[model samples]
Target chain A: MERGGRFHTKSAELLAQVTWEVAGLPDPEEERKRQAAEFAALAAQYHPHPPLARNLIFAFLVGGSICAIGQLFIALFQSLGMTDVQASARASITLLALGSLLTGLGVYDEIGRVGGAGAAIPITGFANSIVSPAMEYRTEGLVFGFAARLFSIAGPVVTFGILAAMASALIRFLVTG
Target chain B: MVTGNAIAIRQASKRLGHQTMRFETAPAVVASASVVGLREGQGPLGRYFETILEDERYGERCWEQAESRILKEAVNTALGLAGWKEDELDALISGDLLNQISASNFASRNTQMPFLGIFSACATIAEGLLLAATLLEAGVAARVIAAASSHHEAAERQFRYPNEFGAQRPMTAQWTATAAGAIALGLPADGGGGAGWGAAADGSTGEAQLLPRITFATVGKVVEMGQKDPYDMGTAEVPAAWDTLLAHFRETGRDPAYYDLILTGDLARIGSEIFREGMRRRGLDVSSRHMDCGVLLYRPEQDVHAGGSGAGCAASVLASYILKEMRKGRFRRVLFVGTGSLHNPVSIQQGEPIPTIAHAVAIEA
Candidate 1:
């Protein structure tokens, strides 16, 4: 199907509605067809590649560079006598905090703008993912408010990942038995 | 006197038409317009060139308007199908071009749903959809949205040059078309689609529910061609698309025969050929109803620079073009694989490699 610029089709509908409402001219079918045709014709012109790769690199560098700073926290956890798991967990938290800070400072955004996936690649992406939603939830409340409400977007990924991981572990145990 | 007409319009609005959701939503697209052909004899908007191109403001203004329209429609349609209202949505997942992200950010400022800005290049659709599907399956939220947009002008100006750059266009660069798109999803629920997702919104009141869960999504490995040439995107991007498609098929352990249709996002002219050949070489016979959105969208005579790339390029194609075709019972199940070149020009300058990513999502008819 052609969702490419399909919004133009929506414009056709809006135009038709407008014409009908404005003139009451027997549904103004011609205008709808004309607008649709115009959109299609315009769309038919030569297309170009957007600066996607360029943006991704920028996002990657910024997000990744910033994330590198967070990675240092992992070393701190380890040197402070934390276990590997604890280090990793604490690292995740620190990364999340740094991510939120970057987000708040609007720095992560520059990374997003340039690196695209490069920034989105590492743990920073996930950290940004959670913090982004959390920041949005702030408008609603910190407690049982916007934060909980915001879970709908990223909530699925975490839940299913855990479930799937658990399921995999169960399968391994059953096989061993 | 001015107040009279305004009051009249407001009063009429209280009486007719479809119901507008009760949540705040804003426009998402942004652009800058300029005209040259007029001075040199191009298209007709020629005479009105100065009036239009005189300011990039209109172009950018129109962009967000279009983005908002398309984005909102996308979420609304999905919400409608799921029978959910705007107020119930948790947040929006989106990606686009621009550091400021005016299109997506401004768009979000008005939504009842919160926002997350993601930039996976054209992979934004797959990326956002991946997260959305993931969130839905976990029952974390009843409804969520993943959307992206790329303004032809904004992308061109920022990434390359003005429209006239077509003459100096290297084989490496492809053309960005003017388009925008958005999508929405709802999760499995006790009775309806889900808790936050309404079952009685818009046309969704009586529709069959969206699939129970998105189930699984595989983020692609960064595959790259040693060389970087914008002109020959086929060689550059073919491997990435092939890698992801093959991996997804492999992980699922499902034969290509099981799928009703398989599609790739924006693998235009050269890349399309490379993809087909690469698949053949891999010993995978996807000879079924497999096709590329780029090829399907236009007639060959209409030469796109290399092909089309943008969130809307595929989103619009999938939502409007493909959805329209689906009504005809063309296929029962389909796979939509979105490909992206996650490279930055800065990396190329720094002599870094061009890494790419592709994400795949399955749509059942």
Candidate 2:
């Protein structure tokens, strides 16, 4: 009786296989893909969209304000009889120092949060990117922690910035010649 | 037509089905403790926590050390509440969200108990509870401690950015909670209470019905459906949670209505909504009784984005609010489903999909 039951189940499975082969139904892989796409769409519906317009306005205001502050510093230095180039350089240095000081005081991050890329696209943001990692890794000791990680975030920016500057200089040299 | 040997084997088996385990004697959770940092202390469930630190550092030198210190404090506090000495525990099962589970290992070092560190990401506490209950039921141990913790700054530096690095987090991003929780489980006094068996010193009677018992556990398989977003872990974790919930209900011959509450660990807002919709599509409406630890941890104005997450998110909620409410006879039965995203920074950077898991433990008051 058990052998007969097993034979009956085997026949049923064979019949099902034949029917599946002949039915021209969607293949298992295609079915799986369709299900996955459907589920992904379902999940994506719930994801909250970030407020892009608000963020952009905030970034513009903050970035413009920083640049305005830099201009004020440049004007003050120029009033002291410095050259235009020297005044601008001094303003940049002053902004970097302020950024580093704010980061050390643990206030720049809050500014970054509010300003979005506005605070981040400025010289102050660059200073923050470098100083924060140094402060965070200081616990790993001065050598391996602070000094090594000082350039961890800013290293990419410096490397790429120098490369791009060289490329621009080459382009200018070729065009002028 | 079954043989006597076959009948004995069937009767002796602890497994209900393929994934669920039923203990012959359920282990009682005698005591539990939760410790949280300042941000979580200011959250909605803050008043329920045993220890709330004004400083996230907890007088420690670094965030990692602070996490370990809080975990140790939670374990000690749980043991103190249970009126059990450190020597009374046979093993400590704990894990945390750090490389090599460093926080748990450092915490366990001070515990001086036989340690078994586990990792299933945020599902760690449920995994630990399952193991502890299994150990107690199997007569391997009389008393055991299960704990998990996660620190926001420590995890952020390891997984995303430096604490002071100013980057705008997306709305889908969850704030990793700086919290720790520990639960002490032991065999019922009537069953395996050997030499050190005694009523808890908390003035409760020694009756088993008075304490919440870890009755059943359903182990989950890793489910990956090509979800790759690290910022949106709630969405990544929903499939695994749904898979585990389905398996638990099917294998255990139970339904959504079997438990008074179905608590999901850190599925937050988006994930919970997705989970409910998925369950509804499957003819099971769990919306009425569902609660998420991530959603419960913080208020909308906390700027936690989606919600709070981490191993400690669920652990702290369970050890504090859920269990406390259970003790007060508010909830009679609970299905604690811990959802976890098992992806690291390297894996995420490599564009690999997040493999997630969920472990469900049934607890009854």
Query: In CAPRI terms, where does candidate 1 land?
Result: incorrect
What tens-digit string does per-residue lDDT give for candidate 2 at A1-177? 766998899998777767777997765656767877887999878877899998999999989999999999999999999999999999999999999999999998988888999999999999999999999999999999999999988999999999999999999999996
Per-candidate RMSD, Å: 25.6, 6.7
The candidate 1 chain B region of ten consecutive residues with least summed lDDT is B22-31
Give stretches of model 1 more than 4 Å off. Answer: A1-177, B1-83, B100-102, B164-166, B170-173, B188-215, B324-328
Reference-based lDDT, each prediction: 0.55, 0.89
Instruction: Assign candidate 2 its CAPRI class.
Output: medium
What lDDT score is found at residue B288 in candidate 2?
97
Task: Give the TM-score comparing model 1 with the true structure, all chains together.
Answer: 0.51
- Which residue ranges in model 2 land beyond 4 Å of their true spot? A1-32, B1-13, B190-209
**RMSD of model 2 against the true structure:** 6.7
By summed lDDT, which 10 consecutive residues of candidate 2 chain B come out lowest? B193-202
